[model samples]
Target: MFEYSIKENCLTNKTILVTGAGAGIGKEAAITYAKLGATVILLGKTVKKLEAVYDEIIALGLAEPAIVPLDLKGATKQNYIDMSSTIASQFGKLDGALLNASTLGELTPFTQIHEQVFSDVMQVNVNAQYLLAQALIPTLLLTEKASLVFTSSSVGSQGRAYWGPYSISKFATEGLMQVIADEYENSSLRTNAINPGATNTNMRASAFPAEDKEKLATTADIMPLYVYLMSDDSLAVNGQTIKAQ
Candidate 1:
């Protein structure tokens, strides 16, 4: 796992947004950020799950988190625009955004890939990310140091036999990260991708049903990379796809 020695309250007064905040790694990241003194915005499709996380954050006496229930699959460009505008209005600036929402789509041979499944994965994994970032750029740029973290996988860089749409979407994700990072190289905004290797997430279970979950790394184990990318410590690192294993 990527290791970093983060101090207490490292993220104080920072307002960070996390997608897929309802469960798994996203849930851990959101709570972790709050614990570190960041006021987090939990963005996810499930209201109940978001509420659960929100309640947990409040109970822990951490920063109060907000919930934005949104389904990336069906959200429009205007939705992202408004969301970004609201974040700017309410928070003054967005210090970081962890774009972690994604779909597994069935793993299948390239020739056997279903049209609908491919479209669904691309919509959530690629298009929504692009639109959200586009809308959030102005707000992100407003902050002195802004981190934009995109989630990736091992298949993002290399092709695998049964990964299909998920693999192709991750390749595009890396491409997107590089393009934005290069464009914003000298700006206040920093862009990067984190390929969280084989964590014991619900998504992981679906990907490898037969594997033993006990041996896989948990969300807590991979958060160092997550925190490092979002902290000022990584200001010099951009346009890189780092692996958390």
Candidate 2:
């Protein structure tokens, strides 16, 4: 678990949108950002889960959060564009966006991979992100300083057997981050990826059911890096992949 003294009110006047905010790392990050005074937009597939997170934030006396129910697998370019428009109308500008929602298709041998599974994984993990980023860039540019954090995996960095489409999608994610980072080198928006190593999340449990869960770090433990990336402290850091452990 990583720890850092969070500067009080570091994210005052900022608006950050987090995908997959219903649970796991995304949920924790949203809570942390709200605690630091950032207005958060919680996006997820399940309305119930998003509402639950919303209620939790309210109970903690954090800033009120907005909920946007969306499933990455089914969202189209127009859907993302509309979402961006709504955000612009409501918040005026976006300070950051965490592309945290992802789907891990069936893990199997390359020869046995199902086409539908592959397509679904790529849709959620890759295409959806590209579309969302494209639509949100205009609003992001409105900020004096903005950040975009993409969720990546270790297997995406190193090809591993049985990792299947998830790994390939992560590689694409890394590439996307680099391209965006380079394109925005002189701009206010900064882009990067973070690998939350072995966190005790549902995704981890699904990927490694046989492993001892107790040995893994909790989602809250890896929040410092998320906070740092969202803060002005990491303004100059771009095109880099950080490991949060």
Candidate 3:
């Protein structure tokens, strides 16, 4: 498992935004951040799941979390800008944002890829990320130091057969991360990507249905990297894709 010695209350007073916070790695990260003293903003397409996460945070006596119900596929740039403004108004500044939500389109031969699947995958994994990052950058700069993390995959940096649009989108994601990191090299905000390798996520299950779930690393096992990226500990770490294995 990835290791980082996170201090207690390392995220105290931080206001962090987590996309896809209703499930999987996103959900775990949100709860972990809250426990470490951040006021978490849970963004997801499902309102019920977001609410459930909110209640879980509250139940743990962690910081109270806010919810933003949004589907990345249908969200417009204006929607993101307005959401960013609301976050700025409500929280004063955003200390971090985890761009963890992504779509896994069908796994098919290159020649067999559907146009709609490609579009949907690109919309969620690339376009939405671009717009959201654009809208949130200013607020992220408001903090003395901030982290903006994009979720990536092994296939992001390497092209593989039949990975299709998901793989291509991740390559774009890594590019976006690098570009933003370069632009913000001297600024308060830093950008990076995380490649969560072979974890027991729903997406992973769908992609590799025959795999043994018990053998794969759980979200809890890989949270050190997640928490580290959000904490002040990683202020100097930027433009790198750190793997959580």
Q: Better model by lDDT, 1 or 3?
A: 3
Clashing pairs in 2: none
Residue ranges of candidate 1 with Cα displaced over 4 Å: none
Q: Could you give me the TM-score of model 1 versus the true structure?
A: 0.99
lDDT of 1 by residue, 38-130 (tens): 999999999999999999999998878989999999999999999999999999999999999999999898999999999999999999999
Whole-model alpha-carbon lDDT for candidate 1? 0.95
Q: Write the per-residue lDDT of candidate 2 for residues 1-245, one digit (tens) a residue.
A: 44656798899999999999999999999999999999999999999999999999999998899999999988889999999999999999999999999988888999999999999999999999999999999999998999999999998799999988999999999999999999999999999999988999998889889999898888888988999899999999999999987
- Whole-model lDDT per candidate: 0.95, 0.93, 0.96
Per residue, candidate 3 scores C-alpha lDDT tens digits across 39-121 of 99999999999999999999999888999999999999999999999999988999999999999999999999999999999
Q: Top model by lDDT, which number? A: 3
Per-prediction TM-score: 0.99, 0.98, 0.99
Give the Å shift of residue 72 in candidate 2.
0.8
> Relative to the unseen true structure, what is the Cα RMSD of model 2?
1.0
lDDT of 2 at 81: 96
